[model samples]
Target: MSQLQDNFGRRFHYLRMSVTDVCNFKCSYCLPDGYHPTGKQHFLSLSEIENLVSAFSQVGTQKIRITGGEPTLRKDFTDIVRIVSDNPSIHTVATTTNGYRLAQHAKEWFDAGLRRINVSVDSLDPKMFYQITGENKFDEVMRGIDAALTAGFERVKVNAVLLKGMNDKDLPRFLNWIKNTPIDLRFIELMETGLGRDYFQAHHLAGADIKAQLQSQGWSLDIADIDDGPAQNFSHPDYRGRIGLIMPYAKNFCATCNRLRVSAKGKLHLCLFTESGLELRDLLQHPDQQAELIERLHAQLAQKKETHYLHQGITGVTQHLASIGG
Candidate 1:
């Protein structure tokens, strides 16, 4: 099998594939105006996804993270999980969701073969959660988390995008809440996208500050696996839960890049802020085309840049986080 490595020698073993771009949440920093369909939303079909995953699995991909506006929105979500988990080479099959459907479908998803789950829970406070996500389903989402735990998902994670004056001060609250929850609560630094320029300016917070605070309070860094996501995880002896920080703005952040993203439309994104994507939908038409698809991916991987130019204020074609399952 050909290794997925770039010119910089960064090998990719993880794939973040988006099943759809139509997110239901209207998060202030992401889809503040809510999701509006521009035209026919031609997301990848189940067969196409099967072929795509098969090709990636052939080329040393060990972990797959299914992302979307909210991947659970798809009717075939469970089937998606089942097929992805069926691949022997892919040891880990995970999905990131909004937590609205977990209460009703967590067991079904778990039974379908999904072993890891990450849910977006921006604020612990009900009112503040509504203020950020523009949805008043805090209680329901909480119930969904409980359901996920009951469904035997030991690797549950919650994500919160750190906003400077908004939820930044809520760290202590998050810390206290997760003391015994056994969840990995991650705080992501706000990235500047085409649609969230003004919002980013107002709310962008340094993840380093939070990491410093965690270190001061005795939270020690945790050892990460080869295919783990970009977050720097930390743990404390007394707490059952863990904390993670994703600092994209930090130096050498891309040195350990191990994941590649494919958008819902089957466009391959070498980087989160790449100028454009390489189309792969046509290659996914048949399972016989697997070799050609892998060839295309490998050829493109060689051209991957050393690092993203986010510091230079180039967000590329990504208008918002929901557009490509950020």
Candidate 2:
């Protein structure tokens, strides 16, 4: 089969699938405090998910990243991982989680063929963690990080979303924590997703500022050769692990975008900020119609916007990061 490419000539090789939208932590920037999950029936069945993965694989998707409001919240999360990993065309199977329950399942997930894990840890301070996530599980999350490293996964990444006057000051703490460990620490720019408009307005920090701060602190950083997704990785002279920056605003990497997202509800989102998507759940239920669905998906990809206008005061399409599988 021919490789899938968008109109802009970027080849699609990565797929991020949201297994479920249910989350335990009410992250200030991700989901609302009173957010409710869709009915169980709304989620794609295990068979449906596998079929979708197969279809994507057939179209040249080489890497699959399983995401969710909290992926580990799903009962069959491991099964989903196994299904994606079993695909011959899939070279990597990774996941991004809140790390609330990773300690209990990191070994299981690794056994199920999960290649890497990215844990979201915005704050090392317990009080700040509670304030950001509305949960007092900071200790548990720390344990989860330890568990992931112990599980011996190929790569363990710690993702910290930099918010001005929020967790931005915690950079030194993160650097100190990861100095002896091999876990890559990534600082992500605050996105203007619609759900957190007020919070975003109050605390959005640019990635450039964070880099400057690190440089001023006498940390020598050199660009690392690893390019996993959109993050621009850098290695420190004194630390064992590398640092990454995902700057959606300050440095747009959309020109080389090569991934597509599938919502838990089975919407094929061509871009993170796109307001429209092609519904795909129904097509998964009918194997005979998969060809048509693939064709439609390609057409949709061709129509993907060249670049997002978030820096120009455009609000993100999806209401919350959870809904879009962030």
- The prediction achieving the highest lDDT against the true structure is 1
- Candidate achieving the largest TM-score: 1
- lDDT (CA) for every model shown? 0.91, 0.84
Candidate 1: tens digits of C-alpha lDDT, residues 1-326: 78898999898999999999988889999899999988999999999999999999988899999999899999989989998999899999899999999999999999988989999999988988999999999999999989989999859999999998878879999999889888999999999998888889999999999999999999999998998989999999989999999999999998999999999999999998875789999999999999899999999988899888887787877888787778
User: Alpha carbon lDDT of residue 124, candidate 2?
Assistant: 90
Q: What is the model-wide C-alpha lDDT for candidate 2? A: 0.84
The sequence of per-residue lDDT tens digits that candidate 2 reaches over residues 139-172 is: 9999999999999999999999888988878987
Sliding window of 10 residues with minimal summed lDDT for model 1: 316-325
Give the local distance difference test score of model 1. Answer: 0.91
